[model samples]
Target chain A: MSAINGQSTNGSTAAPGTPRTGGEVVCDAMLAAGVDVIFGMPGGASLPFYDSLYHYQDRIRHVLIRHEQAAGFAANGYARATGKVGVATSTSGPGATNMVTCMANDIMDSVGVVYITGQVARPAIGSDAFQEADVTGISIPITKHSYLVMDVDDLPRVMSEAFHLASTGRPGPVHVDIPKDVFLETTTETAPDQVNLRGYRPSKVGNARMVRKAAEVINAAERPIIMAGHGIDISGAADELMQLATRGSIPVVSTLHGVGTFPETHPLSFGMLGMHGLAYANFSMRQTDCIIGLGTRFDDRAVGKEDEFGPGAKVVHIDIDPAEIGKVLETDVPIVGDLKLTLQKLLPLIESRDRTPWLDQMNGWRRDHPSLKIPDSPDSVLPQEVVRAIYDISGGEARVIADVGQNQMWASQHFWYERPRMFFSAGGLGPMGYALPAAMGVKLADEKQDVWCVTGDGGLLINIQEFNTLAAEGINVKVAVLNNAHLGMIRQWQEFFYEGRYMGAFLDNPDFAKVAQAFGLHGVGTSSRDEMHEAIAMAHEYDGPVVLDLHVDRVENVYPMIVPGTGVNSVIEDPR
Target chain B: MNGTETHTLVATVADHPGVLTRVASLFRRRGFNIASLAVGHSEEPGYSRMTIAVEGSAEEVKQCEKQLYKLVEVVSVRNLTGAPAVTRELAMIKVRVTSNERPGLAEITDIFRGEIVDVSKTSMIVQMTGAQSKIDRFLDVITEYPIEEISRTGVIAIARDDVGPRNGRARG
Candidate 1:
């Protein structure tokens, strides 16, 4: 029961001496964990902790951010590139409130981040004290879990618990709110307690019964379709999904988040499904008798007009979050557990069925309406062309993270990912500033793994401050921004819905190359299609962050555009 | 910031002394004035109900909820509206206008569906029970005349019979 970091005097039999402050213990624990960087902004409530941090400058590095929200993003990026837990600190009230979205983003994307915030002093907690806030209450729903540290002696355990919570289970953001007085007061409970996270192990294997049931369902069904989502990526079960689809001759369709889960070139692969989904893919979703939803919640965008989603299909929804089961479309069989484990368990239950006819039908649909198209000339590159070039260079196995909007659509429609877990995107909320930070998170999980961040100019700019975070972390993450210089999706809607009265759609250009250069990273711009291959190879060659701002054709809207309230088959390929 | 609008927020929190302070302090720090605060044991024990009528926009209301979520004791919070729920408010208004004024106390009582809880030679205390809008409208029509002390119960609501679940589960 001795102190782990030697910063506290708790539980010691020594003379009645005043104990060290909670902030000292926390700083020691952070140092013991080999943490080198913390991204945050300072405010009144957190002054004492910041003072403690000042003493640990030699061992730890702190990155000050203009906004606390960006601090969270920066920490996330650092964590993503190094596989270490990213850390963020902010004061209570507005500062803490600013971190909710970033924390929620981490939780949703499965990024490991330890977030610490300061609360008002205990005595003045509810007395309308200046700068005081109830940090623990505001973060519950957005975090994996949170703690309010009342006792200064409990600081070691609380900090330790926060780290464990952030790195363990499915990996998410964990928050610890420290009262100002607690951070400043001394404590004598020096014995460090072992962290016990009861019943929170993230086993890579699925429940045996559920896995067997899923396999049996897949083997028995003559015409089955796979609805892969982000969970497949988290579980690293993309390979399993691809093999099952290929061997069983099953067609695979992805929700927006599940974009690169299956290869675009696979015979049985349909494109992205639901609103703004490819026409044939949505049609296939409606026509298929058996739909297997993996890791994706049957969200509004995925299950367009829920009542008519899978008209007569036997749906099997597999996910880690139990709340999501039966959340949207009820499944004939529901498997609530880790996707990778479930798929591994499913291997035995599957028996090959005759899927030649299904494959043929899928091929026929493909032949009739090819989703992937490569640009002809060399001067201008389209989004699909850029994705195609990447696919050709990396083959079909490298993992890709696509940002929101048109670029996401293009990547979903163009990338030929031979394995599952290869595509990552913000599917549930369709959050705009998702890809770059998420890519950083993904890269941190596996550094050697080739990770590509496919983003639009608009989405990229939202969190572009992270570019410096990437450089400082020294993680060589590849970024390809589809620089259309417009809020392309909104402009597309205005073009179609409001007779091209483009209001607030245009954006002034930023010399992205200069921005990248300022971050001490390689930045290249390309309008010529021929230079794309060279640019991609050059990016991979660099040892740190690289941004390839590809100038693309703006008027070229993402195809198979289906108007809302209409069926899946209603689509316009060339809207112009 | 002038002519600030008041809002009604109903919250469920672990019944504790400091919770009220925590809630009030949040509003105070934000420069928001809590016009009226009413708290009592709710439908469930161990959990207390607080009806806080505030003044802000829809965005500000959401921001306040976000701030409230950061508090450990606040389990859930919501803004129940008139369209979907049964909204009820209790107000006791004392008017200084004479009983003999034009369209006086008799007409005001008849229109507000209120009783004169208290009667004096100069003024009458009108007890009105209805939705927030009704109470606001009643007050608006009577503002031209002198008014003394006014106390409102704030707004408390539950889902209408047909709209909410009969069973325990909440379905989307």
Candidate 2:
């Protein structure tokens, strides 16, 4: 009904009298939405979209990843690093299915990512054509929203809505599946200037009365702890979090994803709190009288044995999503709004108080339960020592993207993060093989920022093909493989809970450093404490992508672990 | 039936493809049991209204309401569990009867204000529309005879009087 490709009414710039294909319209919509980069791998079903991408290379940079899974993770990492909406595209069937895990991962971690999948032709959608899959139905429970566009005219609006839903509210993944025919169909549809969804509206401002009630609860309590979560970093509320903690004199403990939100180096900042979290942090949670949960979901990992966690403590929960307010823990004051805005409304009402006795008691616990100490070994290298070596070699300046399992725990424990967005991990879904590809995304987000991918022997092999991507793209991300020749976390659990059977946990492995060199990148291998520091330093100083495989003690276990179905008070420390 | 109260919820959602699947999938994934659900076009253009009866405790039902709102296609959801509302269901019963039994069946159908829609040598179809309890009672009374087939529509409900909009628009 609108003019046909004239001076664009939407933000897209299309020359007058020029015809546009559906693929070009989709690309133009992304441009109008301010997406400068996309991580994707094209296939037969998405060839038309890739063809359009070829022409827009100057405006939109496309990173061709090795696998669709890496594309999804790279997009997720891009979103987490820059707080922008990340975009990934793949073909139908296996390519789209490969992205399911990452979509689940993004939803669990509350990262904003838009996944575009190409479907079969419209007529073949349900006929079981080659490469045809019901991706929209499969992603219904995982994605915040999804669309299968049959009509070419709806492409622009669907693209705009997908980006809007992915980047707003709780910030999760949104999927868009386009038939191959629609990508080649000719259309003059223009992207909308704004989204017009009647059912979708995200709440941003906190209720004034609820803020006052929370302030009252915090002021009257003697020992109050601020349980900060990933929402702090997602909403950019780190400064406000610091203000509230300092003003109220509350000890701040972080969830795994909330690692750097409150600056672990700060005096009031206790370390990460979870199953593998520090003992002092968990002890503070147990002893506190009032718990102020800020931008967190009170996950089962963070709040072990919910009924027993923070017993007799009055709780105040603030989050953007209303469902998360009372989902797990009961709250005395529940404020549903954006975290930064809610904290702004709360800071003025908070009465400045110094609980010297509470701070002194927490300091006493920290002294008595010293964790994260790297054991001195003359001939053997410990995993904790490798983490500490990276931190020392990089001078605590690199952004550490850690993979799952024991290596993730050691990295979180040993690395001291002083700024927000410095520590990234698969906290919620706990997906393995996330570090390398996600590091590619983080480095691409800001080429000058030093990025490190800390993974284990088992996790690295999952996405080892990504090493070629790094070398080809010339992304200088340092890789540290804490090679213990086993799935350390699984083996630890097997030993602790399964009578040390070690079924399927041992990894008969390859030389990872040589694997890196074969991919045309620098490689170094170290097996002793003496070679650990030098290998890490070499990787850090290398101008190109480099891998440092540090062989550590095979049987070392992560300490301060709270056994499953138990409370933080029952944390098990290293007996020695 | 297990002594847990059933909460009736009315939701207005966009009339789009896969909307029903989204709503049903959410209930199943969230571990909520759906006792009954009926959906049809609403008075508003491009929107559909759904009446869902869910079996859960008061807390679980409240969570169900919150979770349903999380779906982007769902415009609004109202829990009409204890609200003043009118509920009804429709049922068609086909009973096997001989010529001798027709009179007795007709007399009973008249008392319940039901109509015999069709009749053959061996069977008679009776159509009944009323509250769920009345329909249940009718089925109970007719089960003594040889019944060939039965079909019943799930419950559909709306707020009574001017309590709320039938199309689920929020009151200004």
The interface RMSD values of the models, given in order, are: 9.5, 0.7
Tens-place lDDT per residue, model 2, A1-576, is 212112222535786335688789878877865778889999889999999999999998899999999999999998999888898999998899999999999999999998999999898888999988899999999999999999988887788788778877799999999999999997666666667676777778789999999999999999999999999998899999999999988999999989999989899998999899999999998889899998899999888988667889999999988889888988899998889988999999999999989999999989999877766676688888888888888889999999999999999999999888899999899899999999999998888989999999999998999999999989889999999999999999999999999899999989888889999989888787777788788788889899988899999999889999998879999887
In terms of lDDT, the best-performing candidate is 2
Model 1 C-alpha lDDT per residue in residues A1-576, reported as the tens digit of each score:
222222232222224344667777777667655567787888888989999899878877776665677677656655644556788899988888888888878876666788889888888887878876666666666676677788887777667767765764456788888888888988765444355433233344556777777777777787788998867655668788877776777888887767666766666667788777766677676678888998887777667676566677888888776546675776878876777767767755677667888777766776776545453544566778888777777776567888888888887767766655567665554677777766765666567788888999999888787787678776567999899889899899899889999999887989887789888878998887767778988876666789998888876687777766665656666432
Lowest lDDT sum, 10 consecutive residues, model 2 chain A, at A1-10
TM-score, chain B, model 2, is 0.88
- Model 2 DockQ (Cα-based): 0.78
All candidates: DockQ: 0.04, 0.78
Q: Where does the lowest 10-residue lDDT sum fall in candidate 1 chain A?
A: A2-11
- Candidate 1: Cα lDDT at A6: 25
Q: Which stretches in model 2 have alpha-carbon errors above 4 Å?
A: A1-11, A15-18, B1-3, B162-172
Q: Pick the candidate with the highest TM-score.
A: 2
Judge the docking of candidate 1 as incorrect, acceptable, medium or high.
incorrect
Distance (Å) between predicted and true CA of B27, model 1? Answer: 21
